[model samples]
Target chain A: MNEALLAELRAALTPARVRTGATELGLYRRDASNIEGSAGVVCFPRTTEEVQACVRACVRHEVPFVPRGSGTGLAGGATPLDHAVVIALTKMDRVLSVDAVNRSAWVEPGVLNLDLTRQVAHLGLHFAPDPSSQQSCSIGGNVANNSGGPHCLADGVTTSHILAAEVVLTDGSVVVLGSEAWETHGLDLRGAFVGSEGMFGIATKLCVRLTQNAPAVTTMLMDFESVDAGAHTVSAIIADGMVPAALEMMDQLCIQAVEAYIHAGLPTDAAAVLLVEVAGLPHGVAADAARIVEIGTAHGARSVRIAQDEAERALLWKGRKTAFGAIARIKPNYYLHDTVVPRRALPDVLRQVYEVVERHDLLVLNVFHAGDGNLHPLLVFDKREPGVMARVHAAGEEIVRISVEAGGVLSGEHGIGLEKRDYMPLMFAPADLAAQAAVRRAFDPTGLANPSKVLPSPAGCGDLQHVPEGAWV
Target chain B: MIDLLAFAAEVGDAEPVTITGLGTRGGAVPDVRVVRAPAGIDWVQADEMTVCCGAGTPVDELVTELAAYRQTVALPAGGTVGGALAVGRADARQLGWGPVRDALLQARYVSAAGEVVKAGGPTVKNVSGFDVCRLLVGSHGTLGFIGEVILRTRPLARHSQWFHRADVHDPSDVFTTLYRPVSVLWNGSAVWVLLEGHPDDVAEQAAVASLVACEGPPALPTGSRRLVPPAQVPLLTGGFVAELGVGVVHHAEASDAAVRPERAQVLDHTVRQALDPSGRLNPGR
Candidate 1:
């Protein structure tokens, strides 16, 4: 059966674009995640018509197909379980059109997030969502994951930025889910299609909403004696009626590693540091910057320093987004958990996160968009260590539980893919999950689309999954 | 307290149900077992900048409550929160704020199966699963019975002023001249600009645009709302008030032209089938 499906896929899209060899399948089995799955065949499709053909071929062969973009997802969303067909979209990269008058652009799904922003910079507008992997991550992946970054605190996530999407449904039929106009009548399938983690379908062409650049931008760094102090300062800034363009926090462990990697001198001794940015008109930005500094000082900040020039501002952001890359300096592997709690609960959540890490005997780094109360607690450890993976998973579960208990969701942006599928029950009741499953079935009734990624095993009859014992199972 | 289960029970065994808010949207009330979502504010998280309210809560009331905390939600005036959401209306401030969907953080609704289901989190950034919350925003109450909602709030601007400019060759020129404007509205003959920011900032942009201070936004003759491509809004002709940069125009009188089609797409039929297979929710919505 597998051989027959491979032959059909190779026929649908010339053999040069279809690969069933063991080596190619090995590379397509997993995303940036640690867990590994199986891939039956990998097809590189370059156009919307080609993508539709691939889906049609997979459906006829009765094989599950997963849409992949750069494979930068950390939650194993691109992992093709059940020997699924991998429709890699890296070759579809292109900026198709730009409507500068309406502040909207049409780009292929494979266009990198940062590349889209850079391509439209001359027009005085840029794409909003900036995932940490923006340099390499595709807009298709951002659409799939509903990705968010530090700037999402001020701007909405990918869903709000995407005005429309041309999606190939599971039945191999192409449909335009939204429109270029500000308002689209009828059910918002476009909103439902995005962030489905490939469960609904694949987005081929995207009409992305471009954000106008602010006239003034100010980036500031504030150091605190302790993580608690830094957490409180975040709350104080928000309480002072200021939502900056971006507000990020980093612990000492993260500070040390990032400084070592970039040599930017990021207060290696301070227990916590904040990187805050506010941008708007010059007069408003000045007032916002001054108020943020005042709030930081009121919360026992050691010093609040403002970046004098654009170069300094860019360097400060570089130190923040390069945080994951700095993990290699401390440990060979890192298991990160993305959860969000109320800003007032940040200090307590951080304290519990530290306790859990210590009890598990793991080194950790903390860096995340603190303004939104999102937490990215990285449990750094060596995988070669016996029984270390088990402890890491256990500690991760505990962190998620505490965040939920503190009126938080399971994830802020990474999504409930393979990483937190089981924990979904902790946040949603049975009916809620059923409703989500029904929505999934609405778009992909056959369930030939990426299966067992977002929903837990046996969400409903429509989903096809070979239920395993655990994450690696 | 609102009993979502009760609403679901009322929808027992696939009986058609229609949601009704205050009579603010007066025309012809659908004849059915009308179910009104809960009314009044549930809680206000001032620090978190979020507010939870029953869907039927009056917009003016919610605005007043949020004003106490010096926060605001972008909702059209003179309607229930649910009424504004049912028709998918957004205030003109969306020029500065984003789409109304961005503020709708969570929703609790009743499925056709008499099941109480919820989507989204009260938190600002949530991507744990499919965004059913936003999907329900403009569904016209066809999918489910929207009971309650959680909306993100923003700090009230320090200063707000409305200005008018006449003989404006184009609204685009007026929009480009302002550094950061809350809204720019244009009728057939005149343009209106609303600026919200620090007094100095608003004053600076007003001077740059050379707009005369006005008491309020210019009102146009009442008519059906028309939606066109944002770029094509300039082509629209009539006694109407059009939101600049946004493609919505309130025309002077009803037009025979149909803006949206009546045919439902495959996904629409599929979602309607999946959620309300028995056609229990507002039919033909």
Candidate 2:
């Protein structure tokens, strides 16, 4: 980074808050993805005003800036490319205010996702979007990715839960998208901004709508003799007119990995397992659970187990959420893909996914949200292996292609960051992509918020961001 | 179903056009040409829980067809699907149905550049690109002429019925006490709660809340609806029917401040201009 820009960043944010050391900058380079980027300098913004100051300085210096939260994103959305200024928002963590009567809360961008639910537990309300990494992922990151969790099957995704956001645009001006009031006017700019991959602006504060706790809950685990049976049960459950709070599936590979790690009593002998949870009134929950179990049994489920208490429910969810971590038992590294296909096309898509993995000579685990058909196929391998990444990339691309061919999308929750930027053309036409570019241009006319992120490279959206002289990708 | 690409050509051939369906809300507008979708009930993916229809499809007709499959989209049935979207109609069941915009999953519309563009996709949850479908909703057709839309559909509740509680001061309390109410409407005097769920669950909630079964939902008087803060619903003097938790009030009289979220005029103008550079889609609606 140039000394002059460093001085300006240091002056705006105290010298202690702005760090340009190689060791510290290395930590800010990449998120959880395999891709890595170099950061020009990093600045810690404690407030929205501080965020605005950082944006203003970046704008004046004509340098691009990336807003980073917990750095838990897997799609590389927070990867600072071309030595962009990294404005870390971790210090702004705070649940600013809670309106219990209205069942809404205003929180700073840096607050942890699960912590918001913990803070508001006493009010009998919780934030709805609970991505598996909710424990460490920041709500700002969730907002940027438009994250979805297991509960999002019934509760909807981050976009549905987020009521409004106070954003600092690329030009250093602040604007509020969406409205706190239910009746909004003009355009749904907030909806457009939610999953922009931080290319539009930075959300300083977010007003998230909290969902009321159901009167009753039940979590059940059903083991099937085959992946076909498990997928069949998922279709039957939804076809029966009851959307379970969550319906998750784990193939034999995932079951073995999870059982080895958590020992949550997952049936390793079964070919597949379905974790179905329902929440509502006591009678409704009971009815829904009974119907789901009946559907599972009819679909060739071998055995069914219901969580006896809250502890057991947590145990079942722990097994599901930690499925990714358990992949280390089979391989040292994994490349996960998020794609959604039609519910009925699950079997075909999985068959193709397995075929692709087998052809590429890689190990993959199928554990994903079955209710919504969002497949998270983990390609497990050792990165140290010679030419393993090439095979992983090939299989990953094929899975996405198959999913999109089955009337699916490029991404369901994990957004299209650097990983899927080039694949956007597969799903969208040149005109469709141009409209998206128009949206980004509407927010950041100079294309300097977080360039080369969502829209593919040849979208004709020019960027004025000054790439450093020697920064390499 | 309407061929949206050819429809875009039609829209492009006739520049500066006005498009609407039924012309119910504000009557017809004189223009170069008026257009409508030539399709209705294009497809209903019951397994995927999504329904696609043309812009000219009648909302009630689409609802009836979806109901046969035990599924329904959260769209108001008073007008055509496109008209309801262009006018951004709010449903009485919004308290539980969620925002109207959330129901739209994918939309195909004609852009200002005289081409067909698709936003979002067939899936219920997608983050591939910008949510231009959402921006098209409630836009009053200034941005583009919507051709067809695919909406996320939910199961039709089994036992949905309305009950009324009289002499209610603050509807927010009742809103907090109920469990997954379909809708809660307050017409200045009585609070009507529409509970939809299993028969036993709805009955128990109704008994617990001490509500009396009413014939139907509260009716809104002849006027435009205003969106007040949920907390401010109780402070309204009178002459308004408020959706308790949803923060929409149907005032008996239309006031000047009637839910026009044009506070940030510059940003709104910039976003509008981004998609409609020629400013010819639905000029000066």
Q: Which candidate leads in lDDT?
A: 2
Clashes of each: 0, 0
Q: List the residue pairs that clash in candidate 1.
A: none
A206-308 in candidate 2: lDDT tens per residue?
A: 9899899887999999999888888988888887788999999999999999999998888899988999999999988898899888889899999999999
True contacts kept of each: 0.71, 0.74
Give the CAPRI rating of model 2. medium
Of the candidates shown, which would achieve the greatest DockQ relative to the real structure? 2
lDDT of 2 by residue, B79-98 (tens): 78887877776688887888
CA deviation > 4 Å runs, candidate 2:
A459-473, B258-263
lDDT of 1 by residue, A1-473 (tens): 37777777777788999987889999998888776889988999888888988999888878999999999888888988888999999999999999886788899999999999999999788898988989999999999999999999988789988888988887777888778767777777888988999999899999999988998999999999999999998988887778899999999999999999998868899999999999988888999999888888988899877898998888899899999999898899888788999998999999999999899898889999999999999889998999998898778878989999999998898877786777777788778888899999888888889987777755433331333334521
Report the Cα lDDT for candidate 2: 0.85
